[model samples]
Target: MTELLLVATGLRKSYGQTAALDNADFSIRPGEVVAVMGPSGSGKSTLLHCLAGIVRPDGGQVRYRHRELSEMSDAERSALRRDEFGFVFQFGQLVPELTCVENVALPLRLNGVKRKEAERRATEWLDRLEVTEVSAKRPGEVSGGQGQRVAVARALVTGPRVVFADEPTGALDSLNGERVMELLTAAARDTRAAVVLVTHEARVAAYSDREVVVRDGRARDLEHAA
Candidate 1:
C-alpha cells in the first residue's frame, strides 16, 4: 500500500452548539490530489482547516507522516505551517501594497531568505504559472485570472509538501477557473506536493485523483467506498 502523507480519524469540531465536523475521516498520499466536495456550510472548509492544523479538533487525531499534529506545540505547528504547507483561498488574497512577485516571495522572505534570492525564485514561479508579464503589477492591476494564477504561484514558491486550497476558483469565470486548476494541479504534481482541494464544483473536483464528500459534518471517501 502507498504511504499516507496525512490522515484524520474520527475527527470532531464544534462552534458553540454547532458541530462543524463530526466523526469525519480522511487521508491522502504523497503527490496525490484529493478534493473535498460539498455544498456551502457543509463543513468542507472546516475539515481542511483541521487537516492543515489550523484548527484543533475536539476529538480524534490528525497524523502527518507518522507524527501527530495535535501533539505539536503552537510554535511547532506554526513553524510546520510556515515551512511545510501552502494555502490558496477563494479571493486570491494577495497583499494589496505588494507587487505580484513580492507577493509570491513573501513566504520565502518570512522563512529568512534574502530579498534578491527570494524574488528571483518567485519570478520563476510566476513564469511557470504563466503570469510573468504581471510580475511587477500589483494585485489590483491584474485581471481575476491573472491574480489567481499569482496566488497559485505564491502557494507553490516555497515548495511546500502539502497545499490546502479552499475554493481556489470560486471568484473566477469557468474558463479562468479551469486554467487555474490546470496550472495548480500540474505544478503540485511536478513538485510531488499533495493537494487538499475544497470545492463544490464537480468540474473542479474532477481534477483530483480522489474525492471525499463532506455532508453535515461527516465525510465519505468515494474511492475507498467503491
Candidate 2:
C-alpha cells in the first residue's frame, strides 16, 4: 500500500445543536484521489473542514502523517495547515490585483520562499495545468475556468502532502468542469499527493480513485475505480 498521508477515525463534529459529522472514518494514501459526495446538509464540508484543521472536531482523531493535528493547539494546527495541507474552494478566491503567477506563488512566498524562485515554481505547476499562457493575467482578466485553474496551480505550488478541494468545478460548465477534473486527478497521480475532493456530481466523482457518499452525517456507500 502507499504511505498513509492522512487518517481520521471516529471523526465527529457539531454546530451548536446540530451534528455535522457523526463518527466518520476516513483515510487517504499518498497518490490517492478520494472524492466525497453528499447532498447539502450532509456534513461533507464539515468533514473537510475538520480534516484541514480549519475547524475543531467534537471528537475523534485526525492525523496528518504522524502528527495528531486534532489535538494540537490552534497556533500549532495553523502552522501544520500552512505547511502540510493545500485548499481549493468553489471560487478561485484569487486576489484580482495580482497576476496569475503571483497568486500561484502566494503560499510559497508566505512560507518565506524568495519571490523569483516562487514564481519559477509557480510557472512550472501552471504549465503542468496548461495555464501558463495566462500567467501574467489577473484573476478578473481571465475566464472562470482559467481563474480556477490558477487556483489549482496555487494550491499545488506549495507541494502539500494533501489537497482538500470543495466543489472545485461547481462554477464551471460541463466542458470546463471536465477539464478541471482532469487537472485535479492528474495532479494527484503525478505529484503523489493525496486529494480529497467534495462534490455531488457523479461525473466529478468518476475522476477519483475512490468515492465515499456522505449521508446523515456519516459515510455510507462507497465506489472505487482506477
Considering every candidate listed, which one attains the maximal TM-score?
1
Model 1 pairs in collision: none
Per-residue lDDT of 20-81 in model 1, one digit per residue for the tens? 99989999988999999998888999999999999999998999999999999999999999
> Could you give me the TM-score of model 1 versus the true structure?
0.97
Worst 10 residues of 2 by lDDT: 217-226
* Candidate 1 residue-wise lDDT at 28: 91
Q: How well does model 2 score by local distance difference test?
A: 0.87
Question: Which runs in model 1 stand beyond 4 Å of their true positions?
Answer: 222-226
RMSD vs true structure, all candidates: 1.2, 2.4
